[model samples]
Target: MSTVNDTKFSFAVFFLTGIPGQKDVHVWISIPFCLMYLISIVGNSVIVFIIKTDPSLHEPMYIFLSILAVTNLSLSISTIPIILGIYLFNSREISLDTCLAQLFSIHFLQCTESSVLLLMAFDRFIVIHDPLRYASVVTLPRIAKMGLVCVLRAVAVVVPLLFLLKRFQYGRANVLSHSCCLHQDVMKMVCSDITVNNIYGLFVKILTMGLDSLLIFLSYVMILKTVMSITSHTESIKAQNTCVSHLFAVIVFYTPEISLSVLHRFGKGSFPLIQILLGYITLLVSPVLNPIVYSMKSKHLHANIIKAFFK
Candidate 1:
């Protein structure tokens, strides 16, 4: 019953939506969600643990992988609580401040993940393009610095979004389209003109993920060229094989993300259920798959995991 003019940011509460038209089966809907979170948490945790404890795995590549595992773990942790709360307890109401915090954390981690993938691509490129200098050029200290820059870049870009959303006046119709808060979902609920918000959101996406995607593509192109120039066919195949896991990681992370972003911007008339599903996939799939893909592809990691757990 509150008018747009009467609503204050401090007092505003947003309702989150879960599994459209399945309010009766919210508890049932949570089973798969819970499983995905469990896999993401335990899988990524083991990856990080192995990397941290093993001295032989302290190279730049494994260190980067550990950073990525930590990022995936953080991303899953940020959203799982509220999502499970909504499904199990029907606790869908989220305060404006909490919603904004969730939004920031999710997007920041996303940007950080994109950065990590870019770093991985660069790592692969160095390993393939210049194997001897790989250790010299991509040292652990440099990798640590790169990881710090990724976090800083994410912070710089995502923090401004909090301020941008704060200036908007929201109305009583505060139901979010997803079980967790997203910038686009929250921006849609604002009663004020969101042109600036939309523009800035797009700008951030372009500057971070968009740019990262382009760089990753360029890195791969160079990697392929380097591989082809190798006169030894077996060596070329071997070098190309090293990149397969990182390539799969890129596809798993970016495909749903790009689909969701395009759907939000251009698929206004598209089914709401499709958007909701893509939203969940964008948030959950990479976290669940990355650890599996890397473990299966990297013999060293696979052996370590088996030796640690099975032995």
Candidate 2:
């Protein structure tokens, strides 16, 4: 047993438990995780490559799509090493600094994805509501600036978490529930009072994920209103068709996350395996699904992918 003062500012390592009570079959579990990571990496990378090499895709919408792919890849890359290590190599011990870095990168990339989706919504809204000014309003330079601001905003919000968590003395068992480090999970191990950490974590969640989800919803509502007002039924259908991919992406991205967060926060007494499974789904599902969804929905992208592969 460790004491507070003894470990104060002296904590240096954390042991990651991949999934509680599933140790015997951790190897079997890695099979699906490895498959998902491979698919996500390849799928998102293909999207980025297609968008970059195709001259016709140099528009705001596809630009945002490329950014989404890049963000998904970042998210997957951020978490994969530790996940593979824990499951395959039995390397569960992560240095304090490494854990902190992983925690920051994972959360930062998640927040950036949310922001990019929000920007995608805005792009759709502009194109649909004011098609005449779409090109002028959402210029390449503006999109570049928007991506920069999204990353900077995530950094601004997540950097404080590092400082806040660092101030605490974690003298308890530093075993994490998931393969990857998360702000909330790591905070639970601190020996000192973590009231501020909890409160601020909730605040940051509401500020980033909560608020972004709300705005994305509102953007779609407005989009629906505009689409319905279109005189031609064919035009309305086309407009709605443009949103199918994004809508699917948003659903996969938020549903698992919201469910996992709720389960962690309030679903006490839930099965540990269920919680661990949900955590993996939340982290892995969207990246693997997003590019596939987009490719299936967007005829142009789909054709481009097929052409690129077959040619």
Candidate 3:
């Protein structure tokens, strides 16, 4: 048990845990993780490259997609080093500073991704609800400003978490539940009073992800209403189809997050392996799947992907 002094400074070195009870198979497990990381990097990079190089793909939707791709790439890059180190090299020890940095990066990127998704939802709604005015409403400059706001908002919300955490002394066991450091996982290791941290953390989550989700839901409802009011059934279906890829992206991003929250709150006695696996899904799956979802669903993007790769 490592201890910190009254200065609120921690010299503690935290050990990241891999899948519980799977030490012997960690090497084998790393293979699939490596593949997923590779796919995430390559897929998101291709998406970004296609969007950047093609003049036709410079619209608000594709610009937003490029931002999402960059976010996914950063998210994956932040976690891959620690995860692969743990599974492949059995390098599980992470310094307190490094752990806090990882925690900040993961949460910040998650919030930014949520904001981007909400922006995408808004984009789709505008396109469907008022196609003629979308050009004036959702211009490239406005999209750039929105993207900047998302990043700055995430920083403002998540940076305080570091200060809140820094005031604590993590004298208890420093073994984190997941290979990557999460705010909640790190919070659990603190031996000091955590009431403020808990309250503030919850507040940030609600303000950022929770609020974004509600607005996204409302946007979709309005979209549905507009689509229904359209007299042509084919047009309604076409409008609905525009959202399928984004819907998949939302599901891919949020399902694991929701599951992990439920697991942490109610499934305390659940299997440790299950907990770790869910954590991996939360961190890894969105980056791995988002590009594939868009590539398969968007005809323009799909064609470009083929041209870039196959031709």
Best first by TM-score, ranked:
1, 3, 2
Residue-level lDDT of model 3, residues 1-73, one tens digit each, is: 2332643355677899998888999999899889999999999999999999989899999999999999999
Q: Write down the TM-score of every candidate.
A: 0.96, 0.94, 0.95
Please give the CA lDDT of all the candidate structures: 0.91, 0.87, 0.89
Superposed on all Cα atoms, model 3 deviates from the true structure by an RMSD in Å of 2.2
Clashing residue pair totals per candidate (backbone < 3 A): 0, 0, 0
Question: Between 1 and 3, whose TM-score is larger?
Answer: 1
Best candidate, lDDT: 1
| lDDT of each residue in 186-269, candidate 1, tens digit only | 888887788998899999989999999999999999999999899998999899889999999999888889888888888884
Best by TM-score: 1
TM-score for predicted model 2 compared with the true structure: 0.94
Instruction: For candidate 2, write residues 243-274 as lDDT tens digits.
Output: 98898888888887887777767776366677
List where candidate 1 sits over 4 angstroms from the true fold.
1-7
